[model samples]
Target: MLKLMKLPTAWGLRNASPFNLKAEALLTMSGQAYESIEALPNKGPKGKLPALIDGEQVIGDSSLIQRHLEDKYEARFDDGLSEVELADAVAYRRMAEEWLYFINLWVRWIECPTITRDAFFSGIPWPLRGLVFGRLQKDVKRTLHGQGLGRHTREEIYGFGEEALAAIAARIGSGPFFFGDTPRSVDAALYPQLLNVAEAPYDTPLREAARKHAVLTDYVRRCDQTIFAAREDLPNVA
Candidate 1:
């Protein structure tokens, strides 16, 4: 069994961090037994979550973890697809992870008018959580600005994000998963971010924009109802 260390679930999400959700989904879809361990924020290699431990080998990053699974455990992670389709999935996966991922961050750490920050900071002690949150918020904002997304207006950002969602929905078509009948490697990367934003508690512009595409909502529900259902080895957060 593989062990994945990541942040605990929060904000009405299973595994508040999308990378964590990606790891869990890959493991589940791969038919591999595994357990989840709650890891500290920005604690793993390159300061991220969902680091996988397989015996003596520790893998970092969601993409790298998926590759490790495919290369070492199951070469069929992207199975059932022609090379061109696999290439397309890889492109969408990158778009979801890099662009949509940051847009969701913008919503949470920048434009959100709700308790997302507080919920995230709840992991820390009472006195220091606020201070830590402020510091981290500044860092996140700086990162977003450097990523070139912070310059856009909220309206622009929401519109930009919705376009990406639309692309994913179209590519998924009427299929149960992105690549057709079965979940693809792209689904592992894309579903988490979509679920996190679309199912967010507040009715913000970003969430509203995401919800406009019926297929996007359905895709997320399908993924959640299928891969993200409760399991015995799931962990309890502090």
Candidate 2:
């Protein structure tokens, strides 16, 4: 049996972490079964969620996990696409995981608003949860600062996130998936973040911007229905 380490679930997704969701999506796309369990913040290689263990092989990072699966199975996510198209798919995958991911983090941590903060605090056990959570928040703030989003105003941050969403929406363009017909690895990486922005209970400027795009929201639902519907942790379609 295979196991995945990830965060607690929020909304209807398997996990709140985009990388974890991506790994799960990749696994779903691979037609493989794996179980997910909680991972401490610093567990696994590189201290990240979405690590995978198959027998003695321990792989960390969503991208690394993707590579491992492809190598072990000798399969390709963009199986039917041309070389150029596969290259395009990989490009979008990086944009979603590398660029869009940071923007989503700004809305969650930097904006902190109330719902997200409360959710974070609720994850900690009391007595020490407050102190530990506060320290964690501070560390995240510094990380965002070093990453450059912390320097921007709230509106600026939302605007940046919106731009990334717009690029995604534009690329999708009424297609069933990013590349049309079949979904590539990037679709697996993308669905969770767009779903997060669109369906999160708390109001956010990023959500507002995302809601304006029917295509993107529709795509999220489609992915959820296709890849996530059978899981026990899956939620009702939104």
Candidate 3:
């Protein structure tokens, strides 16, 4: 069985935080049976969530995990994508990983502070909610600053986010999924970022733009139902 080392379920919505969703999607699409290992302070890699453990080996980072899974289960992981399709898929995936990171930070910090705050509070046990909120706020601040997107105020970020979403939506207009016919690696990479934007507690114009796009809304719903079924259990790494 494949053992996924991941964070608590509540943190799953965080942007680069789609590690869990991607891992779950890969597992489900491949029809593989796997166990999950909750990564711990001393036991796992120093960075991020949704690490993978297969037998005695541990893999960290989503992209690396995907590669590892593909190598391990060659037939199952193979999408049989063509060369041009594969190139397009990888390009979009890169955009999702790199560009969406900033978009996510902007949304969480400047754009939807209230929603993030509430989400932070709700994620913790009642007793630790206060402490968790404080830590999360500080952490978010540091992350935003580190990413350089934190320099912009909410309004500025919102403007930028709107343009970004418009561009994405335009690209997506070319087909049902980013790749047209099938859900490719690009769809896997981009979907979660859009999902976070759509579902986040903010009623900003950017989110409104997302809501207006019928294709994006349908894509998100389909990804949620197909790749991330509500009942699927994730690794309980705390």
Considering every candidate listed, which one attains the maximal TM-score? 1
- State the number of backbone clashes in model 1: 0
lDDT for each residue of candidate 2 in 136-208, tens digit (9 for 90 to 100): 7788789888988788887788778889889889999988988887767878888887887788775877888
Comparing candidate 1 with candidate 2, which one achieves the higher lDDT? Answer: 1
lDDT per model vs. reference: 0.80, 0.77, 0.66
Regions of model 3 farther than 4 Å from truth:
10-17, 36-44, 75-82, 122-128, 226-238
TM-score of candidate 2 relative to the true fold? 0.90
Compared with the true structure, model 1 gives a TM-score of: 0.91
Please tell me which model should have the higher TM-score, number 1 or number 2: 1
Listed in order, each prediction's TM-score against the native is 0.91, 0.90, 0.78
Candidate 2: deviation at residue 214, Å? 0.5
Query: Which order, best to worst by TM-score?
Result: 1, 2, 3
Off by over 4 Å in 2: 123-127, 229-238
Q: Mind giving the per-residue lDDT tens digits that candidate 3 earns over 40-101?
A: 33455746677778888878777777787678776244367678877867766776666665
lDDT of 1 by residue, 164-212 (tens): 9888878888878887777777887888889888887756877887888
In candidate 3, position 133 carries an lDDT of 64
* Quality of model 3 by C-alpha lDDT: 0.66
